[model samples]
Target chain A: MTEAHSQRPGVEIEFRSVTKTYPGQDTPAIDNLSLTVPAGDICCLVGPSGGGKTTAMKLVNRLIDFNEGEILIGGSGVRDVDITALRRDIGYVIQQVGLFPHMTIEANIGVVPRLLGWSADRIKARAVELLDLVRLDQNFAKRYPSQLSGGQQQRVGLARALAVDPPVMLMDEPFGALDPITRNEIQDEFLKLQNEIAKTVIFVTHDIDEAIKMGDRIAVLRQGGVLAQYGTADELLGSPADEYVADFVGADRGLKRLSLRLMRDLVKVSGENHAAPADAPTVKGSATLRTGLSVLFASGSRVLKVTHDDDSATVIGTVTLDQLQDAVYETAPKAPTDVVVAGEA
Target chain B: MSFPTQVIPNFSGPNCAGQFFCWDWVGANWFSVLQPALIQHIWISALAVLFGLVISIAAALYAVRNSWFEKGFSALATFLYTVPALAFFLLMVPITGLNVGTVLIGLTGYTLLLLFANTVTGLRAAPPETIAAADGMGLTRNQVLFKVQLPLALPSIMAGIRIAVVTVISLETVAAQVVQAGLGTPLFNAQRNVFTTGLITTGLLAIALALVADALVVQLQKLVTPWVQARR
Candidate 1:
């Protein structure tokens, strides 16, 4: 399996027993942190302020040194590499957008490339391509940072990060400073960009909602830089590691789970219901229960006919609330294995 | 009624237009007497201002982020300022007697007093956010100091330069007393001759030079500080 995985190229970022402590501090900022983020997925670090989420993100690029441990990018130690070269090889976006007020957007995006000594023509072309990638016009390239709105400045920041076309990206609350509407727009746009690029990303945020929306895996951090929990979003949501994790996830764990829980895992029916309608209410395989609920409500049908998009929206089975609770508790006897198809209604 | 005729002395003398103070003396020697020294004074003052500005900016950049360096430079410059100009020139007279060197050193030392304070003040005037933003962008220390801090600190730095320029020009006249040249020498020469007209003309010319240099610095400041320009 390892060889098969190694046959293909991928970025794997790992922190091994990393411990960081500031002088005169009672505790380490990051205490014995060890986590793995596989390539082509967004691994979010979410927790309250001073949770070491930002510190963990910074360590990925060696912005802050890890005192007791090593961090590996694609399985090589970061300390072994030159910091400037290493940083140039990884994309970084911070909350404040940090656009150089003195330089044009094109120049800002072209910074790392210029440092790497790319040709002026190539750098300009890459700058234009990155601007378009981040959903900005090439016409805006000549404008200074002061001419841009905060959201626009952030797009430029993202473009600048992506300038060198690195395989790994570190984001420290990239959308945290924007308004809610703009934040969502940028987040959605970033996700789209990430999907196409497939870069291994470590994103830090104080928002659990954003974590659930963006993370393939979520690492919940606690005060004093402790890892409260690290698992799939569903795993953490369905079964919190501890009270600290639970509280950090907040009182709306069920609602969070609605987004995390697959429709297949959450759907259930009574054992006695052998006969089913051919045209019962069903949701698309990709639809969340939040969407499923809305469909079920709009259809005015208690029994939801779960349909799969690729499976031609065929009615597979019906799901009711009792089954949902049983599925949540995992108390129901296992259903027939062939009864529901994966990614099928 | 016998009113006593009281003799009141005429304290306000008759207006003698050209008897003692000849207005024509100013027009005749305005270019000859005042022009060369005034031009030289302007050049000397400008050069000293330029030199002082460069040193101050360099020192300020080094000092702003490092507390020890800032304190050291400030303390040393302050000590230099405390030495009286006359005593400083007299001390320099033995080494480099009665020439431009004596004047230049005295004026340079005076300039540092204003320049050092201004440089430090200008650097501190930059917002902390600006520094953080530069760091967040992965700008090197030198890049942040030059590209962000220096530009942001320009107004304060210029203000200091202007103050230093004015102070140096004024001090240059005092240095002139020791050097035996410049506007001060001419005023002393006129005082020796007891010619009130020459004194008035030379004094007016010095004041005019000071005003012109001051106005020019202000214009240069406006040209450099476009951000502050927008604020106004």
Candidate 2:
């Protein structure tokens, strides 16, 4: 992870005392909101509707201009560049996916690149590359958006956003509409994709669980667009600043936190190489601690075998319930506090 | 009297000289008169639709951006549409001097209400999410309007054009009242002379021309919006 972080390139987005008010509204939708997402970090802005979370994301790309203060991308004001050029350089995904129904998947993915004036050949090449990056088949590119399933359309939407290889991404509930199984599938794929791309992402979602799962840093916003708390997901769930955030994180935060740790991180290597127990339940090293715990309980076992395939499926280690609990507590603080702040300044 | 008789040859009932229809008269006039009228009818209708489309699209785009403009333009187009076609043609004759100009101006006005209303509806019908996505991706105002909004609105716009073309084709026949061109001139002459074959041939040909124009527009719409047809 550290090695990947060292190589990742991304832009920093800073919102300094930003405020946006709709016409004829008495109160500002976003009132003096301030936050910062460091380069190569996924900062999830989680809040209820009308909490200004979506509005805050929009302000980043200047989709909706702010009434006061400024938004800076990579230390430069968003307004400094031409609007189209600025947009071309920032990837954007929405809940609806908004894939142009008229265009084929290839054309949809190539939109930003074409807007940037790339040649036809270059755009086609980039479209194929993006389809692969988003884990979609190249053949799918020629299909129209209407022909794609909901999950496929979302993937294409993500591919289109990444077409220009923009360093920053503004995602407004990109997976909010999918069914739970597909949503989880795409979210996992998105996380894997982020590892390769390392974009500075400002993701907005009303789902706190999703935010906790995907965000490197989570910003909890209240009704008036107030930044109630901003910190690592562990910190936000472990210690919410107020009742509003506490309720938002919900009662099952402990289980949610288990999702943050991997079984590999909690596995205890056995000193003696023993023959594999045929009856012992096996969990992949890549499985979440939560899944390992579930398998342990379901199989009525004190310990579960951790298997990872290098050449063949071999028992690499064992993870006991005790070790899983200890590992969870031990690694709780280890969640990167790269920029953990409590309340707004 | 002989000139009228030569053009019509027979004014009587269904079967004249034991023939069901005046095939001879139609064949004779096909090159000399009816053929020219068919060409002129097509020319006038095509010009009216072309000019009307340009004007309406421009107005609709503008109206989509401004609510006041939408309301004002719509009301004006409706007013122009409500004006009797014959009266409007007659009104333009004084200024246009019984030329193609008088007929085209009136026909264009008749098309404006349908085209303008549909264009506005189409432009406004672009999904909000789609518009936001386009804008968020850094498309300029013009690019969004043209590349995103316009293309998405094309299905509705094409429907409007189809209706407008058929309407203009039928209306161009009215142009024959003032100018001696189009299928209407022969049909009117047949009515005056009570020539059964000339009336049937001209009336049937006018319907056929409108249907042909309509079919061509439908094909053009399908060609441009393959995505729409492909969905089905």
Top-TM-score candidate index = 2
Q: After superposition, how far is residue A297 of candidate 1 from its true place, in Å?
A: 5.8
lDDT of each: 0.73, 0.81
Return the lDDT, model 2, position B140.
86
The chain A TM-scores for the candidates, taken one by one, are: 0.84, 0.83
Error of 2 at B120 (Å): 1.2
Candidate 2 residue spans exceeding 4 A from truth: A1-8, A21-27, A267-284, A299-332, A335-345, B1-20
Candidate 2 lDDT by residue in tens digits, B1-232: 1122354333442245545477666655676678888998899899999999999999988888899988998898899999877788888888889888888888899899999988888888888888888988888888889998889888888999999999988877777888777788988877887667788898899999999999999999999987786551
Give the top-scoring candidate (lDDT). 2
TM-score versus the correct structure, for each prediction = 0.79, 0.88
Per-residue lDDT of A273-345 in model 1, one digit per residue for the tens? 4344665566776666656666767877666766565784675455665555444455222333512211112
True contacts recovered per prediction: 0.07, 0.69
Error of 1 at A148 (Å): 3.0
- Which residue pairs of candidate 2 clash? none
